[model samples]
Target: MDEKKIAVIGAGIMGISALRRLSENKRFLLTCFERNYDLGGLWVYTDQTENDVYGRKINSAMYSNLQTNLPKQLMQLEGFPMDEKCPSFPTHTDVLAYIRKVADQCDIRKYIKFNTEVQLVTPVSENTQDTKWLVTYGDNRKKNDSQVEVFDAVIVCNGNCSIPNYPMIDNEKEFGGLVIHSIRYRRPELFAGLNVAVLGASHSGMDICHDVSKHAKKVYLCHRGSKLPTFLPANVTEKTSGFKRFTSSSIILDDNDIIQIDAVIYCTGFKYDFSFLPEGILEVGQNGVVCNLYKYILPRQYSTIFFMGLMRLYILFFPYGDHEASYIKAMLEGSVDIPAYKERIEVIDDDSKRPWLYNSHWEWDKELAGIAGNFEPFQSALKKIRDHVLEVKAKDFSKFRLDAFKITGSDSFEIL
Candidate 1:
């Protein structure tokens, strides 16, 4: 059997896991491209805001004060364990060190091309049966210099947090405030004594509001009626409706009420974009809902192309990425079979019944990122983790940082 050449698109958490797993197989030759000189992806915090030191717009949303909302146990890669001495909700620096430790222990650093960026990945064949890709990449040191490599498989692990989705609001241009996306958010001190309205009330929004309240005069948490935290800082307030329009001095809500504020921080989430992919090969909307993806791994047209770290946004990313890598490995090694295209469509259709707004899929975006954790006993383990996470959260949202848990077995865990 001939060895397959594989191109890994990012050196983030998912890319690191891919390298750790894929390089173990002698049947695959790998090349990893990382735009940064290091790994850690979105978890890497930088004081440089809105862009890198080179002035390119910054994609990482990590704030200096950020701590892992998920426990250390949930965040670990399958075989890797975070130090038991570390806090359950360790600081961002701790997370980075753990990831680097995994990369070092697995010796996957040798497979990566640091300080390189992948510009494009295009199909070498227009035929549906052919699954070859030409990847064009360049080193950051040299401008206008690049090389194209032909590979039998391409794994895209560049995370989904880079692109900011500046929402379209009516009369937005009329506003005169320092409007910024969550990606540019570094600290809450910037909002000192100012009235700020936070858009999008998910994890990021909630966390940012909690942080900004310490500095801002007041924070109005804007959302479309999701569950609100029982505890918020004294300066924070919740608004149930969404922005209907925006004026230079104020914002109008769906109820025709208006509120004046100094600045607007859009914790409004991100758009998962893969513009480098050739047209018709992978069609994903702004919400990151992809079509023609069989189990969201191989696209219906190509078995050799796989996408990792693109599944459910709310789960533990490291383990899911590992699960995705392992599944693809089994498929490539001929131990698992790719299902029929029609079967793929049916499975995806059956899973799209999840009830939620598809902010990205727009309309077809209601599907859950469920297929990746389907492997048995592992799925059982994930369920236990979810329950444990919810239990700890419900117990004390304020003190979860002190809480800890250890996975005792594949299907079980014990609180530490």
Candidate 2:
């Protein structure tokens, strides 16, 4: 059998987990590309604040004090559970170590080309069966002189959070306070004895506001949400209205209220960063969602290319990656046949009008899970996910992530 040449991009959790499934048999000749010196993707913590240098952008969004918001049990790769020593919510360092541990266990280090940044991925022809892609990358030694390789398929796991989404704070350059996104946020000591406004109430917004409130004299959590959590610290006051504009030292609320603040920290979240992909093939923008995807895995225009771990899920991420990887593997093996390419295009076209990006993850993931569930390991993980997400959502995010669990068997665990 001619081994299928598969290229896995980015050595993050999704990239590595996908590698585990893709390299299941000798039938695959897999190659993994990572720009970093090592793996762990976003989990690898770097102190640098500037996300972009020259042309490339830093992919990792991990903060120094950040811990896994979800329990370790929920975050485990289906077959490979997190180490017993790891706590429920492991730290940034702990998550990186766990990824390395998975890599060592899977013996995938040999397949990866470290410090190699992928420059471009484009299709070769109009024929569907002739699924050849040109993957160009630059090695550390000679970065200017790049090289290209042909692969049967491409799995994009570079992550969506590499590009931080900071909407314009409409004003005539009046605001002069320090503006920092959550990605560059490390510690809160910089806001000591000062007034800080944390924008957006997303996960990062909530977490960053919590961190800043400890040091800032008064932390104003300015968000558009109707209600804010009451459990927030005394120093952190939630504002339901959004920003109208800002002055040199004061922030004007949408309701025409003004508050003096020393800094404006935007926990504004991120957008999908897929610059390596061909510009015309995919339409990913500042909207924070990837469009024209069939089942949210394969792009409708390019079925051979798959993007993993882009969906916003309430459940753990590792299992989602595992399921996606398994499905991609199955598709390559022809064991699972999705709808015809034409039919897929129609379905995506119709759904494109709706809020497909945010609302379609559950159904798409479920469908993929059902298809991949026919295989070993993934079957168990998928079975529990539907119930698990519902159960987890029923509880409070702060307290729920703290609950401990013990893995009793493969793809199975009991909440402790």
Candidate 3:
């Protein structure tokens, strides 16, 4: 058996899982490229938001006080539990430490190239079964110092939250207030004593709004969603209408209410950035959804190319990556047959939503685990914990994280 050379991009959670799974068989020669000095990806929080000393855009979206929205039990990778002494909803530092521990236990650091960035990845031959990939990368600081390497396969585990998606407002240019994306947001002190308008009602949007409310004079939690959490801070007011436009010192809501605000924080999520890959290799939709993927992991035309952790999940990301890594391992090791290109295209075309896996992770995890051969079934307790967390959050938006939980059985959990 010939050793297959594989390039895994980004030593984040997804990349670590891929490296761990693929390195199991000695036949795979894995080389992982990470731009940072260490693993942990987005969990690696830095006070510097815009650019590092090397003039690179900071990749972490972690805020100073951010804790795991999902509990540690649900966030654990298979057979790798977080520290028992740590709280269920551990802080970002705790999560990063856990990620480091996983990598150390798996001995995945040997395959990783720290301080290296993958500049581009292109298929050597478009239509061949044995098509190779050209991975061009170099020192993250030295733009001109690039080198190319050929590999039998490529895995893209670079995260999605790095590049922020800022929605255009009608008169945003005329606004005098400061405007920034949630990706650049780091602390609540920045909004102290000022009336702020937080745009978006998604997880980050709601969380940021709540965070800012602590220091801000007033926070308008603006969103398009009809259902707003009733348990908002006294200073945070729910605004269900969309943003009509922005004035110099105020914002016009869809309801024609003009409210004075000192700043606008867009928690409008992020764009899926695969700018390094050539156009035809993968197709991202205009609305920011990945369209060229078959199962949110495999590209329709390139069986050797896998994109891990592309879907938005309500479940913990570790298990999601674990399931994906298992499937990719099976495909790379010749344990499972890769689907025909035509079949893959048909499956993608029939589904309107290609990679939005929110609320459907259980079935998806089971399907991937089953395909990966002998693996334990997706645990029922995880789903229970997730649902319990959601219920707790819905009932008490600001105080849910204060509660801790312990899994008691395969389908039960006890709150502490």
Candidate 4:
């Protein structure tokens, strides 16, 4: 078989993993494009929330003083454990360092084109088996100097967190206070001495509420979810009723009560931005849900194009990337049999909103690893430990970060 020229869209966690695994196969000629000068993607922190040094709007949502939501054990890629001295939930800097170490050790940086942003990706031909992609990319600083290159396959690892999902709130513009998304949020000191309302109670919402509560005069955690941390900060108030409208100096709840607040920080999460890809190929719908993916990895229309790191697999993203990269390698090498177009499309559950495999994520990873023929199944202890961590977090969100656990066996762990 001829060398299969492939173009990877990013140099983030999943991009690095894909480069490492795919490059291992002698039949592949790989080139990875990274817009930023360095790797680490969103894990790379910046104080400038709006724009980068190149004048491009910053897409990374990493903030100062942020720590991993999951323990380090669940964050490691295959065959590479995080630093032993690192805390259970290491800081953002520590995670970035670990990602760099993995890329360096794997020698994947040689294929990277840094400071180059991908502008567009389009199919050169409709023939799935021999399909080629026209990838247009150029220096991040230059606008009209895009260069096009043809590749046998295109792997999208640009990630979903780059685009902030701002939901519509009635009369939101009328709100006199400052409004910002979690992506723009950095230091808690920004909210010092002010009453802030945090919308959404997910991991980011909860963490931001906790951080701001220490400096802000008060924080109102507004969410519709029922399961929330029981032990919230003293200054933090939980509001189950959703936001109805925004007033000039306050917000009106669904029950018609008004709460005075100085500012609002939206923790409503992110959306998928595939502007580079042609329309009709991939459609992003309500709540940022994308459909027509066979397993959230491959698009129903093309076999040569693959989407990596798109699943909402919580803390298992690193392992999931490894499995996906390996599986892609097998599929390209003709070692794994792919289902027909109709069969693939028929198996996908369009009703499922989110791209993630919630409860079946581990099983899905196992299935991918098995198909890859070179990877091992996930450790049984991982799922158990993850479940335990989730349980602890629900009871006391603050305690989960401080608590550590050591894996004792395939299905057990000892608290440290």
Q: Work out the TM-score per prediction.
A: 0.89, 0.88, 0.96, 0.95
Write the residue-wise lDDT of candidate 1 on 1-416 in tens digits.
Answer: 58999999998898988888888898899999998878888878888876565545666889988998887776888778899888878888999999999999998888889878888898888546446999999886676869899999899998888888888889988999878889889988999999999998777887788888989998998888865645667888889889899989999988788989989989877777788887787667435576557666777667778898766546566776777787777777776667777787687666454554323322221123233232322344555666666665555455556656776776777767
For every candidate, C-alpha RMSD to the true structure in Å: 4.1, 3.5, 1.7, 1.9
Q: What is the alpha-carbon RMSD of candidate 4 to the true structure?
A: 1.9
lDDT of 1 at 40: 81
lDDT of each residue in 1-416, candidate 4, tens digit only: 78999999999998998998898887899999999989999998989988777798898898897998888888888889998899998999999999999999988899999999899998897646447999999998876778999999989999889889887899999988999999999999999999999999987998999999989999999988674646999999899878899989999988787899999999999988788997877766555666667676787778899888866677577877888888888888888876678876776654354345456787777777776687887888988888888888889888888788898998888889
Better of 2 and 4 by TM-score: 4
lDDT, candidate 3, equals 0.85
lDDT (C-alpha) at residue 292 in model 3: 70
Candidate 3 ranges beyond 4 A from true positions: 353-359
lDDT per residue for candidate 2 within 60-175, as digits (tens), equals 77876687666676677866777788887789898899889989999999999988989888788754634789999987545496999999888998876777888677772777
Give the per-residue lDDT digits (tens) of candidate 3, residues 1-416.
68999999998899989988888899999999999988889989999988898888897899998977888887888889889898878999998999899999999999999889888888899767558999999998776879999999999999998888888889999999889999889999999999999999878987888888889999999888786655888888888888999999999999998899999999988887888997876677756667678777787777888899876676778877887888888888888888888988887786545344555768777777777784665678878778878887888778778778888888888888
lDDT for residue 373 in candidate 3, whole number 0-100: 81
Mark the regions of model 1 whose C-alpha exceeds 4 Å error after superposition.
226-229, 285-287, 353-376, 379-382, 391-397, 408-412
TM-score of 1: 0.89
Clashes of each: 3, 0, 0, 0
Model 2 residue 54 lDDT score: 41
For each candidate in the order shown, give its overall lDDT on alpha carbons. 0.77, 0.76, 0.85, 0.86
